[model samples]
Target: MQSQPVLLTAGPRHELPVTWQLSGHARRLVSVAVAGLLIAVITRRPEFVGLAAPALLLLLPGRGRQPDHLGIEIATPAGQVTEGSQAAVGVRISGQGAGQVRLRLHPGNWISLAGESPGEDGWFNFRFVPGRWGARQLGTLEVVIFDRWRLAACRVLTSLPPVICYPEPARLGSLVVLSKLPARLGEHTSRRPGEGVEFAGVREFVPGDRQRRINWPATTRRGTLQLNTFTAERAQTTVILMDISVDVGAAGRSSADLAVRAAAGTAAAYLAARDRVGLISYGKHLRWIAPAAGRRQAERISYLIAAGAGPPYPLEMLGSLAGDILPPGALVIVFSPLLTLRLIESLRALRERGFAAVVVDVLTAQPGTGHGRYRATADLARRIWRMEQEAIRFSLREIGIPVVHWDGQSALDEPLAPFTRRQVVSR
Candidate 1:
């Protein structure tokens, strides 16, 4: 997606209350100096007159001045940035007068910030680099205020609302097409005689054979009429099922990241191949899109994935969702790092219902060891965890389902290359 300003604000902004405070005991100094001066004059002693200097300056009217109305205008020129890219954040304080002003920006975990402090002119532009994916909101910005005397600070929380940070999809060119094709006109050759570019076997002239398909040479050689046949090219429907049950592995490089990236790439690749695509996201809730084809489908998939970057549903109705929306023989690709018996049952149900299904396993590596002093025990635990993961793989393979791992290091090759669709059996 092209990056644009997710938010922009300029011109006269609503003003914040202008509050002032005493600097270095200014009130005490002034009161003491005046009392001393009166005492000195009444007591006929001018020696204490020097004490009046500290109070006189502070007591002067308007010496510590404040702006009539403090206002801030923030403009995020590149308010929307792709993940792992940088943009500029522009901040201009309107009522910046005297003293010193510093922008106290609390950047979110999804961004790394660095920039020079705003000067007396109150204009600060900084580079904002986005880290992880999502429409992450920008952090809060607080303006630290210091009077001319350099004592007593008043923090004015300006109105620089959080803007969305768009996360770009990973580079996905193609997918290993192995699912069974339904009867439709598309790019994929069905290999049966219908309408397509590739030629199949030939036969003697049939009742419905077109004159253009007749092989003149073959007809003359055979001393009879002959006709040509070609395989039918058809589009396939691919459904991307995102299982946001949980995130695993390390922070920043978690399984959720891998799943989301892979899902996006897979959708893009399928769409490019002229395949009908749809999405079913199960993250705390089930959201779905029926089979469709077009640029709008890709955009909808991206938005759905970004919006569902959260925990999965507490219930186990993912199978129901799949059964309702998926047609027979549609390739169902599930992107997830989570595995449960309920999910396994769902997969079994899909296969039972004649759906072509595969699992894109997002968790590539093992989890980190726990923090403890029991070294031998930790080693044993790691071994057991690996065994459990191996069991999951074994079970999936038993059901004729292939689990492809996305390491997030390179493009995911044809995961379904070595696999075939399971034959549907009637109960």
Candidate 2:
């Protein structure tokens, strides 16, 4: 692999000076010499002095050579990659040193390295695969150079730059149809009749009815002018609202992670259908991307999902979203754990604003009581929490919103399958 000209930074690398130290082989030989000399003097034996003579001669620094300058460059894979994919990293060491160069890599979280050993030409090439999404560190790397006589060596250590990994999208066979669709060209069939390929029904032709749309069979049977009508193919604006306020469950299977994965999948599916899709992430702060239709929009939403982290603040309600944040008549699909009361109020507010919504409950785990003196208190709290969660679901249903549960074990589209037939309506 050709090495790029970027240098690795341990920290403030330019400001610090490189230092050299005795190699392990040299240190061991010196220790042996010292011990042998001390034992010979204590036992008054001249044979011990002979044993230390070879060690002392080998430790002589006359033949040791030091490089005038040492440098390192690493070439990492450019651009963003999806999770569970492999990328190559190249390490190149250069300088004037008549010695053996060695490289060592320490893998970091979510990253695994392969073929860590260097080649005969002293270039360390490694292939790494990221296991999870988000910005993750590649690892810490160390390069060691030993002198020709193996007396002294110099070591350079630095950390590799972080790589951005996008989550692997889940498979979604179909999307939930919205109650209302925007007046724009798209792939979905709308209830409104207009110029489209799918035939809706036949109606009596009026004065301005086009001749090409006239239904010959219906016109002959009715003995009057008749024309075929078709449903208008219009796109609907879909906004994916992610409630990242609180995350539950284990690391990869956390509610926040599942929400992100669902967001990516849903965005991809809608974008493929030529529907305008947007994203709204509400935690301590509100972040949103305006609705847009294209492959580039899918990438933008994926990047945001991977990098966005909601900040913490005091609990408060998100009363209503502005028109720009959520376009008029847009279908709002919320991915949340439903743990915060403030978020529940926001869903209610969405209904009041005349927006249709579907909520996918991403909470995978429930609270449990452990065996202890305070088990009674713990059990009571657990029951109350469960009751509160149930109440939230029931309240959403009463307000004309559908709450579907996803445990992360089933396909994301499974919970959403019901909405495909029954559209989410605003009351």
Candidate 3:
């Protein structure tokens, strides 16, 4: 999605009192005045008093007045933003006799300003890219307003709205065509013969066959009438089941993060193919979007994908996903690290229920044994973990579920290429 500003600047808040203080420049002026007076007393120089008089006059009471009204507005976009994309945050200062506006912005994790600070016109036009996904606060904005003579200043703290950053789907130009399509109008060419543009095969000319479908070459070779048959174009349901049970790996490169990005890519590919796509974030709780198709559905799925970047959800026991949540004959594409046995059992349940499925392993690396006291113990435990992971993959394959490993270093298309060659077979 193209990036745009999604938030409006706030209006002036007169009720919020602004407490002004002597600015550093003002404090320096006082020191200058005191030094000049002391030098004049010691040397009896009248010219020193002349220099200190202006400094003392400027420091007199009521020389600098407090701002009558002060307001700070953040004009940055706050809605959905794509990961790795730059966002422009604009802060505007508005009020009568508003002092020189200076902002101290506290940037969030993986979020940094492109430049040093906001420009002279009270606009923070620097671009910042969010390294991670989810609803994240850009940071707190501390606005300091200074008087005309730079003698006094007041601070107004404003919390910037959390931006919902959406993970950009991988560049997947291909779609995984299902072996069987539901009996509904869509983009995929079904195996069943019906009305479509793609040719299925040649068949004996029937009474109801159209003359346009007649194959003259086949008829001439066989000395009998034959006609071309076309398969029906139909849509299928695709459910993206993501396992957020355990997140492994680094902050931005975690298994859960990779899975969310992959799921988004898969959903986009299927939805572009005119297939009904649904999402199920099976972790702390079952958050799902029923099978549907449209631009809105894409937005809904993207929003849900952003939610996966949050802190780990509380552990929830998994028995099995509800049957009603999954459409009959729907394709279940599981994006998981396969960290839990319960998730494996869930996939088993899916296969038993006759759902065609594929597992995209998002585990990028094995847990490492660092140079520590428990290095040997950790290595042994790592070996055990590898065995468990392999056993899980083997067991799933045994149950007719194809498990594909996505190391995240290469394009997802490489691992998913095999699925595109053939349709997923439901057990």
Give lDDT for model 2: 0.79
lDDT of 3 by residue, 1-427 (tens): 4444435344333334578878888898899999999999999998998879999888775375576556655665655567887776767767727467777777876686655444456555546788887888888778787777778877878787677788867767777778788899998888899999999999899897899989999999998899999999999889999887788898878898888888888899889988999988877666778789998999888988886533333333233555555888888889999987778887887788788888999988678885778888999999998898899999999988899989766778889899887766553
Clashes of 3: 1
Error of 2 at 350 (Å): 1.3
lDDT of each: 0.69, 0.79, 0.79
Residue pairs in clash, model 2 = none
Which stretches of model 2 miss by more than 4 angstroms?
A: 1-17, 60-62, 114-123, 206-212, 309-317
**Model 2: lDDT of residue 256:** 83
Stretch of 10 with least lDDT, candidate 2: 7-16
Instruction: Tell me the RMSD of model 3 versus the true structure.
Output: 3.6
Q: Which stretches of candidate 1 lie over 4 Å from their true place?
A: 1-15, 21-68, 73-80, 95-104, 114-125, 144-154, 163-168, 201-228, 309-314, 322-324, 367-373, 414-427
Q: Tell me the tens digit of each residue's lDDT in model 1 across 350-393.
A: 76666667787888657566667876788889999888888887
lDDT of 2 by residue, 42-155 (tens): 999989999899988988862554665666766666656667666656677777357777788887878776445453455567777677788878888887878877788878
Structure candidate 3, residue pairs in collision: 6-77
